[model samples]
Target: MQSFRTEIENPVVERDIIELEKKISLFRTGQIDEEKFRSLRLARGIYGQRQPGVQMIRIKLPYGKVTSEQLHRICKVSDEYSTGRLHITTRQDIQIHYVSLDRTPALWAELDKDDVTIREACGNTVRNITASETAGVDPREPFDVTPYADAAFRYMLRNPVGQEMGRKFKISFSSSEEDTALSYLHDLGFIAQIREENGTKVRGFKVLLGGGLGSQPRHADVVYEFLPTDQLIPFIEAVVRVFDRHGERAKRMKARMKFLISGIGLEAFMQLVEEEKTALPFKTYPIDHETYEKAQTLPNPPSVEVAEPTDESYLKWRKTNVFPQKQPGFYTLGIRVPLGDFRTDVARKLADLVKTYANNEIRFTLRQNIIIRDVKESLIAFFYQELKKLNMAAFGYNTTGDITACPGTDTCNLGIASSTGAAVVLEELIANEYPQYLYNSDLTIKISGCMNACGQHNMASIGFQGMSIKAGKLVLPALQVLLGGATLGGGQGIFADKVIKIPSKRGPEALRALLDDYEEHAQAEEAFHEYYQRLGQMYFYELLKPLSSTDNLAPYDFVDWGNEEEYVKAIGVGECAGVVIDLVATLLLEAEEKLSLAQESLAEKKWSDGIYHTYAAMVNAAKAILTSESINTNSYASIISSFDEHLVSSGKVSLGSTLSDIVYQIKTNEPTEAFAQNYLEDARRVFSGINAFREKEVNA
Candidate 1:
């Protein structure tokens, strides 16, 4: 038998309570080795998010399903080690924040005790497997995909081939027609399908491959109309193996499976998978259909005892947010969790409610939403009340579908602006200004702070990215708009074409104008994306000419910024920036509390005024670093330095400066920008350490 020690060889093992206490003492005494410290930190699930000092630890719930015990553990971990909050990701994963490196490993061990694994959560490997949360309960599903999802997860866990894929791989299974799994955008997508073979129903899947969305979005190709369920695992293994052998390993951007599918043509790739499948040395074990059936029949939900409701509000919710199940009088409720954010307390409450009303089950949707399956008619009222108390009773569904915003400047290291804050503001604007149209159209507006596209902006009906420009020696915040991307079922794809550029502050107005045009000119029953595409760019351009024009420019002179020679020909590449907080008083107070607890020295008297002043101070510091004689010596470093210099010369600081400061000024009199500069310097130091380490290993 394998020793339990071997099974827990990772930092999770060292994070045992006793070991953790010893490590904490070492860290407190400054005796910890830096490299080991970093490894242990990572092993414990603590990640240096996009912000300096603030960590985001991803808690992996295998198969996207967690027991009540696990949920409670997660809640406790977040409350004790993080920001007392949790974020439910689109991949059905949960992320907690503010965990320190010293506390990470212990937290992971705690999670391990509850059967959670955080391995490969962020690295260049197969990511969390996604499936229709309501897989077994939804009646519309031909077969439950939960078994397939679980089998795939076990088959791929720590598999050598998957340990180092060219890029992250995403796989999802949808057993229903509603497409709640967002299969169209995954690297690999499997949809349950059935066909009568000699009067017998044979279960299989329609396979999709290489679909992805970022700056260059593409829909998945339906390479195979049907593949037997038993052959599914081997077929997927073949596809991934092919990619492992031939996929580009040098160009990071071009390494995605989508690029491979595009380079090798769908027919050729499918042929290669078939050939490889024949020679594969392994086959997946048969699914235990009996066990699954028994699990499926565990218990029925309580029936509703009240009379059917006649209220329009409830009726609207039922129509838009509920999906029919194969079982009579049972339904799956799709609860929209706007922006994919929820508090830990709320999460616990939800877990309890699910236990009571949803047959002890819940599923997460790709849209950063949740679903309570097996809900009965009688329990609707109780479920409704609980959901309302948690502020999750909104019936938006596909109507005014919440803005999908990446954790831009707030936490991600690669943001150009505050995408989350911007999204919240834009959502509010839409709610207030266009309340009547909220339920009228299936419109999705997504925003990314930068081009990395964590928000999946490229696939939305409307999309925007944070940007900036130099205007008479001043850097002005701006946004780039994309239009007409909407994919219905099948492999039908539409790319979100660039429309115009405008001040970031004016995003709401721009959206309003675009929506107005859609409302006025759309043909009957036309989807917004379809309408925009059918109308062609010219008509919409003409309609939006007023908004596109610069101050004092005639309509004819207003050229689309996207079409400009510089933007058109320029390579769309940029580095990620560190995290930034909105400098509000409450946030400042929180920061102060953290600093005090850390026993860091700081002047707190002028905190309010100092915050605004920091922006300018950071700009100057950046200028000094960029113009330094040493920075100009290295060509690669010089390029980055020069860009910073340009921003500074234009009287601006790169937004990333907020998280890149080194030797942060703790005095309230010091500019907030100075602290940002210190953060940037710290980032450089870390990079230097990494480079030096790489060089030493190479020499050795």
Candidate 2:
């Protein structure tokens, strides 16, 4: 760790690594509580894998854009510190597996050298902000959203408001009304929009709020039809503040922003957002697009004529994997990476390939694939030949053959079965038997190792979730077949209905049955989504119900896919979100930490951050006192109200009127310099009064 210390040029990031090193030492020595230490490391993007002792390090790539140099840097880090294997997630982030937990800091230090980050990649923070992979190249998009997406990522990277929350908050930016980023399924989604105002073209977004996908997926509601791009950042900040204050803290399953919106309808949540506007630091946060929208240098292809490949496979590959960009004379080539896994050797070569044949950049798509943009037309054949050498010239880019899946039981602790393994089988089945389905974009297939839907099985036209069934006394691995899910576009989508469960080995047979029925009876004009709705869920269930029969289970039915051993179900604890610690001492220590942070923010004159820190400090202080009396508080709002009823109303602690008045003053006043200082002073006073009351109670 000390060896890499001097290598990291950024002082703040270097300090963060040093702090993590110290905390790891303390944790190993049992000086720090396990749960507390977990929270600290999670916020830093280090996660524990199912395999004991090692970790899965999620490398943060903003909007999935990677410069050639950055890609090579990631490959180097993976080769040295991890298994040399890189996996792309559904959220457009890359993950490396089986890394030693102790070496994470060194790995992070190496990544920092290239300006890539893993901070806030996991554990209850604003996750990697995603956008349409085709943002800059798509023909139908109004304007590229690269700048706005970059702005959101930069502003919220380590912002105090989103540092901790009841659950994760996901944000996305779509390039156009096509909503290729799947804006309808994010906590906050921004679809790029342009309107002519006073004869000037104005850029804005159709904002969608509170959408999420897990076991129960919810479509996001439109927060604004056309919000000027300037208001995007401020609006998101205020919404996060509200979520941090009132979102559920105890029940892990119901802690997402979608639940909060559902519990208190969208109108009520919007009202709360309105109430938080004055406290926001900026009224309109403008993002500069000069750099983000700049065009790349056009490549000069070889002047000599080159023979084009005559292979039939190359034609199929060309048709599905290449897109003519809106920019004349340039094309974007999509690489269908099977199962989102590729060795570092391929990655290094691919990195060099892009720099040589196209622009020095690439974008990782939401479907877990890579897209190389701005390629010269003359270089298409050269790229095809080069990709053929690397065996990365697969035809289907985002079609049925290009199946999307999470790394289910392979590494994820929450995985009940092998999602990736099943994905491999399904992809082979499509390429070998159902070859006609290769270019069929309407027929989507996605699988999850479990119901958490990391694979986004809930939103696929044909989805499968990992499950287990009891057959006599033995437990057999199963897949819950689902149907009818589709993204309706323009901020609309439908979640699949669970059709039936079949033995894991019988999954292939079930797919065959579903397809056979669809091919024979479906109208030629009907897409998969239309056919599914026309046929209904129960109809498909009955069509495939024969595969669900357990009476004929074979010996292979007990084993999960890609596993040789007999499957014994073992699901480990999920650390997707941190559990709120209930200890009074811990709460007090957290309060003091917040106070220290408050001082730092005050010194920086970040009034909004400082004020929020002070507010959190006072609430934590009140909770500490309440805990001393054996009273427990759930949410931040309840903590304030209970303090008033138990201490302020009883005259044990005085703030002139009520604790609510003291704690809730942030809403009444803007986050000005004067108000920030005054609020900090009031927090100091309230903190002191709470300590005094606690001492008195202890003495009695």
Error of 1 at 49 (Å): 1.7
Best by lDDT: 2
Q: Report every candidate's CA lDDT.
A: 0.62, 0.88
Q: Estimate each model's TM-score.
A: 0.72, 0.97
lDDT digits (tens) for residues 1-700 of candidate 1: 2133234554434434345456557656766654333333343334566555667887765456876667777888888888777777767888887777656656766667667777666555677898878778766788888888888887776454454445667898886656657678888988888989999998888888998877677788787788788877787777776665456544567777888889879888777676554335445446565586776754465555655556876776666777767777777787878778888889898888777667775666666777777777667766766677898877766565477776666666566655676678777887788765557547788888777677777777888886664444444456778888775754455668877776665667788888888778889989888898898877766665566434643322222222221211112212211111112222222233333322221143333223323322332233233333233311212333453455433543334343223222222223243553443344344333323433454477
Q: By TM-score, who's the top model here?
A: 2
Cα lDDT, model 2, residue 631: 61
Query: Tens digit of lDDT per residue, candidate 2, span 360-396?
Result: 8888989999999998887788889888999999998
Candidate 1: stretches off by over 4 Å: 1-46, 264-279, 283-285, 298-316, 548-700
RMSD of each: 16.5, 1.8
Q: Which pairs of residues clash in candidate 2, taking residues 3 or more apart in a chain or in different chains? A: none
Runs off by more than 4 Å, candidate 2: 301-305, 626-632, 651-657, 693-700
lDDT of 1: 0.62
